[model samples]
Target chain A: MVEAFAVASGKGGTGKTTSTLALGMALAEEYDVTVVDADTGMANLLFHAGLADVETTLHDVLVEGGAPVEAATYERFGMRVVPCGTSLAAFEAAEPERLRAVVADLAADADVLLLDSPATLGSKSAILPIVLADRVVIVLQATIPAVSDGLKVQEYALSYGTDVAGTIFNRVRGDVESAAEKADRYFEGPLLATVPESEAAQQARAAGRPLLAHAPDSEAATAYRAAAARLDPRDGDSGDVADRFRSAVVPDPP
Target chain B: MIPEGELLRSRVVTDLATALEDVLDRHLDGYAVLAPRETLLGAADGRGVLTFEDGVPACAYHVETDRGGPAALGDVGAGPYRFELYALEAAALEIAHDADELRVPPGMPAERLAGDPALATRTRRRAGVDADRPDDGGALEAFLEDEATVERIRESARREARRRAEEWGLGDALADRPDG
Candidate 1:
């Protein structure tokens, strides 16, 4: 079965898109992965993936009655991407609920699908991705507000019957051990991985490439690989922390 | 029928209608009577039928001069002799294609707009409107008169309504409603 993971955040500028790109590239190392830009309003994933000027986008598929498969831009870091348009008119015209069919069609071809969601809570644009995905991975900084927002998103996802896969603590500055423990306690889900603040991330962004493809040996890239390993469904020990936390905290779904 | 130039000139009449609405709402206790000069003139010409767009008085109108003169009303003679009021009606239209082009962020390449299918469609539609517009100072009239432009606006409104209904989980109920 294909595992669809939605990378979302409570607030903007939390490195959510960056984490999605890195994790997608790392996961593509061993599996067929497709990263979808589900942020219909302020889409930037295409720019980061060097497909900014792609002819077709998710807007065309969702709003303009174009085929979903036609929107996919292949061969970007050995992964497929359905980038969203950055036009306000397109944003106004799109039907967010139509993403269900798009994601379902994409999931059939790929082993893993990562949805890069917008950072808005309760809005149609943000909720559609979470509702359509099998699980959600929240990307957040190691701060009170960020962690609080991530928990709210986790709660929102659970309300819709989707599972909270875990949280990725990105751009961890100074110490890792304390940040990991704090993140684990606050997130209520597994602390999947904590990526360090590195110049390599900036360099990779500047070069319009994924961290793994730009600097394979970089610290940030290595952390993403570890995160991807835990995300792989083939591994039996992948979701131990998440399973334990879910059982302890979340009641059995009706 | 109003001349094309007169219809185009009605664009400025929006301000007069707004002013009349504001003044009447503040002072008048009940309904106010205002008639377009064309309607009065048509009545004098023995034409019984007077037509206006959507019940809005078209063209200019002044205060009734036969009502015991201006000084008979309090402070009427101290002000201007002629008062013009034009009833306003809302008209929906598509945004000009160049609107998105103008909003493109500084330092960003213009090619990105061309690559986006929806933006391209909007730009193309606006371009079509611009190309079809008459150069003889009746652009607004031509735009409103164009069947394609009016249909595009209607289609956009329908799509917007359907999209909203779907988002709120009311699509089934909306579909069950009687067709317009």
Candidate 2:
């Protein structure tokens, strides 16, 4: 019984990987967490987790005679990181349903799964994987267009009858008070968190280290933690949230 | 919601294969096509996978065959099945995360029915479509977006199929997905 959250931002550079890895570490205290490389397009979650040399990865699992799922699965801050790994192109050639099937298998093993989706819907070539998640968290920066894009996704989510957890303003700069207030008012759900822009963050990703691991005390880290704290596994209540997905209906299902 | 990694399962893999096979049969019919035993739709390295075609081809081909008979309309049975199959591949496109409209172009049948439940009212109006209003009730353009409106979608598809059947001289009653 897996409770999954899809971290989506239609626009790039929204700190989706940072949030995913940070939440992966933060959520580890309660249950078995796994980060799914749902970002099949340009997967970079592994690099953020600092496990570049991973051996038996998902790419291998897709092909014949590859390592086992246990072998491909690795530990990251008490949580497991299912490396989508290299050889991604070959897997994609297999197509969407196959990709969704593979992603479903990985999500089944974890108590909670965090999917780092690509920013562009077009980049979301692996469509089934996104729809498979129990929840979708839209991460956005402090910009009108970004929030608007996130809202559209939120509207699409309404058909499922589940409200999007809310938007997280990543890399916020200056005292944009009005912008923040307006953005909050515009959203249908909570505006979960606001992460400040940090030079340390730019440095950490550049140095290939997670901010929570590299600079735990950073302001951005604190914001991430606060946002992370809001996500209560208890609220999900014994896998009923994701398990009872049938209660949610398709949006505009023609 | 399906979890991220859950798709990697062998059992799920078989289920997906079956779904895709059904899609192939629904659209391609008698055409020789291969559904890759396994397809991967993941993304990594800053780019989504390609080769995994998510959009309907912009091209459409109308092949007239002597053996298909004058009344046969479009023959997806033999050569040039790509266009016809693509036209009937709305379900396949949905699996690919593509919201392509089979009734739109290239693959769209000349005639369409308003049998879709979502558009039951519109479906009835489009029953005997006239060409002056191309976007009229019976045209493919009149179909709604949500496929979950099972009756509307099927009725819409039926109308389009029927229209095309008439234009091409093919008879009525093309096998459409039942409302079950």
Candidate 3:
């Protein structure tokens, strides 16, 4: 079965896109992965993935009635990508509701699909990726505001009947144990991985490459691999955490 | 909401095509009517022949009746329709028409046009158009079609884009900043 994970965050600057790309690269080691830039309004994943100049994008599929397969341009590094256009015209013209169909079409070919969603939870377009996904993996920093915002995203995903796969604590710094304990307590699901702040991640972003490709030996890349391992839907352990959390919160009396 | 450039382009193209059709209806005997495919949504069918110019749907035509002509001519279905082609912008406008409602006038500002309660509710019910305030024509078209309107729309789109970009931290990501 194809498993689609929408990488989302309540607020911006949470390394959501980076985590999506990094985890995608790691998952590609064993599965056919496709990372989609579902953030139609402010698309930057193409640039991050060094595919900024691609002519065909998700905009064409959603707006111009083009085939979804035509939008998959970058097919290398054991993965593919459906990039979104940066122009305001493309964003305005796109039919956000069509994403459900697009996702369905893509599921035929990909084993793992990672959608990098927009930061905002307000826009109908922003919620589309999560609504269509089988699971949602939130990326967030370890802080009160970030945790609260991540919880909002979690609740939003749950409202749509999508499973919260887990949360990845990105850019962990200073104290690892304390951050992990705090995140475990606040977050509803499992803490997938704690990626430490590293210069290699920044360098990979600058080089427009995934950390797995740019710095394979880096700590950030290792954390991403660990996270991807946990996210593997084929693994029997990778069940819906939201269901478990729900049962725990309101357990049925025996 | 429709982009100003796209709204303007669609209006110009549809107006020119509609004017041509009106003239053809008045004069020519059994002549084919050519129009922008998008504007002629109510009329276009499987039999209509769509032609592309510069990678855009320039015009679409359907023969009223097939008058036996030269074999080569029949292949292209070209006839004495006196076709007048006008090149406008490439973008196509999505015009929503409910058989029960009055057709939105071409070139009418989107905000003013959507202000009609019936049309507003109808457009909102449609999937692709804006749900709250469907601006099919555009918001800034009330001003003179000069640099002011252009600048205003440009500024508005820029601000909107910037706000979205900031919300996603796209600027910092594009600049390769660690702060993102």
* lDDT (Cα, tens digit) per residue for candidate 1, span A198-239: 788878778777778888898888988888788754332224
Give candidate 3's error at residue A55 in angstroms. Answer: 1.6
Show where candidate 3 strays beyond 4 Å: A235-254, B1-180
lDDT of 2 by residue, B53-133 (tens): 222112111122211111121111111111111223233333333323222321112221111111222222333333222
Mark the 10 consecutive residues where model 2 chain B has the least summed lDDT.
Answer: B43-52
> Per-model C-alpha lDDT, please?
0.53, 0.48, 0.54
Expressed as tens digits, the lDDT of each residue in A208-238 for candidate 2 is 6778888889998888888877876433443
Chain B TM-score of every predicted model: 0.22, 0.16, 0.20
Task: Give RMSD to native, each candidate.
Answer: 21.1, 20.4, 23.1
Local distance difference test, candidate 3: 0.54
Instruction: Tell me how far candidate 2 lies from the true structure as C-alpha RMSD in angstroms.
Output: 20.4
Q: Could you estimate the TM-score for every candidate?
A: 0.54, 0.53, 0.53
